[model samples]
Target: MKALLVIASLVASIMMTYAASPSLEKLQEGEKIKVRYTSQGCFHSSNYLMDFSPNKVSIYEFLDKKNKNPTKIGELTLSDGDTAGLDKLFAFYGNGKEKIGCTTVDNISITVIDKDGNTKATYHYNDGSGQAHRLEGVITLGEIVHRLRP
Candidate 1:
């Protein structure tokens, strides 16, 4: 009876962990994420973080194919005075081919700003294509979250 009880408790704990949504601690390295941020003009990047933690994430700018060692732009922190909530972060990446004469590639960074001129969150989107034209924008966290949510 004791053994059975222990097994049942362990099983219940495991189930609860699986059912729970990811918290800051569950975030892992190399895991892709969609983040949104607000700044002077909103910046978004799909290739945003080379490294991340619950407290801070390093930001990177999109690099041209020929440019070696992409520039390390800035860093975002969850505790940054400007940040308000988790709803602000977003990240995504995609690649496709265009029907035009050349390939189209778009690497984007998104950020949002409050009335006081503070950053909310930063997002990254790398949309690469085989066409020559590029389509990109810097949007709010609310916009991307709505578009991405099922």
Candidate 2:
């Protein structure tokens, strides 16, 4: 009975992994993503680094102006569900149409790096307000990421 139970557990784990979307699978494979937002009118800025590996969710952030350094703030772990949710949040932008067609923001930068620390994708915005929805969503995501922090 113990052997059968172990086999069932393994099957279930495999099924769960296979059920993940391709993007989510990449996230789980140690892809590191970073998002940064700056308020040009003020000195306040927010930066976050997300790694979906073991206990790697809470989002390392740097919100200082003078320090120019990032301090570990949240200790949240990125669950599979959370990663899926993030997929939903950003999937709209990947529809083959550049959402930022000439639009801009105060200052925003998003970067994705592969497991080996190679750049996968990057988006940068400045001096406009086209990606407000995405930017706002990122801010909301940061809040959610912080909540899961230990």
Top-lDDT candidate index: 2
lDDT by residue (1-150, candidate 2, tens digit) is 999999999999887644432254356456666656444334334455554443355455656756367766656665666665556545533333444343223454567777788876665545343443454333334445447552
- The whole-model C-alpha lDDT of candidate 1 against the native structure comes to 0.38
lDDT of 1 at 10: 100
Poorest lDDT segment (10 consecutive residues) of candidate 1: 88-97
Reference-based TM-score, model 1? 0.32
What is residue 2's positional error in candidate 1, in angstroms?
2.5
Clashes of each: 36, 7
Worst 10 residues of 2 by lDDT: 96-105
Model 2, residue 58: C-alpha shift (Å): 4.3
Per-candidate Cα RMSD to the true structure, in Å, reads 13.5, 11.9
TM-score of 2: 0.51
Residue lDDT tens for model 1, 1-150:
999999999999886644333223334443333332221212532332233444555654335654346566665454532122332222122222223232333444544333355553443454332222122332333332233332
- Provide the TM-score for each candidate, comma-separated: 0.32, 0.51
